[model samples]
Target: MCKNMKELQTVSERIFSLEQKKAQKKKEMDELEKEIKMLKNETSSYMKKRQKNELNIAGFTILFTAFARSSFDKDAFIAGESNGAELYRKYSKEIPMERVTVKVAK
Candidate 1:
């Protein structure tokens, strides 16, 4: 019948449209995967906190910053506050072998 033929045609068109949409999504996902892999190589990752130098503590939460630097106490990183940030508790007096910096995450 003509009616049956039309119905079959309509169903075929819908299936083709769905397949097109699925392919588009697959392409988008593949592009995103490539982008993520690229970013991973273009960045630095730290497994644990580490110091930048022997005299500086690198890992400190920067709540605030000002025109100031921490002065050495007894030739060691004792309790020192930077700008309005809290005085980070130093892990050891061995010239800060590890440093960590914290950022406020919204």
Candidate 2:
């Protein structure tokens, strides 16, 4: 029983340490993403001012392209079809999934 208890404690400690590391990494990633977004905006504005669609710097090529995105109009589809809801439900499927959540308790 003593050995089992020690093993359980070790596992718990490892989980707590991993959770703390995950949190710290997440914070770092968030900060990096913000910096990246700011740099991208600045670069885009500079490119626009110079009227350049593409740029090659340090062996990296960046291209700014404009395109249209088409999205389904749910309301329009439902209005146009007599049994839109039924059809939508028929095409949709429920996917079963499982997840494990770990946290460090304060």
Leading candidate by TM-score: 2
**Candidate 2 has which clashing residue pairs, if any?**
none
lDDT of 1 at 51: 18
| Superposition error at 103 for model 2 (Å) | 38
What shift in Å separates residue 65 of candidate 2 from its native position after superposition?
Answer: 1.6
Give one clash count per candidate, in the order shown. 7, 0
TM-score of each: 0.40, 0.60
lDDT of 1 by residue, 1-106 (tens): 3379889899889999999999999999999989866553332132223312222225533331112334434444443535222323342223422222344443
Q: Name the top lDDT candidate.
A: 2
Report how far residue 89 has shifted in candidate 2, in Å. 23
The global C-alpha lDDT for each of the candidates, from Candidate 1 onward, is 0.47, 0.65
Worst ten in a row by lDDT for model 2: 97-106
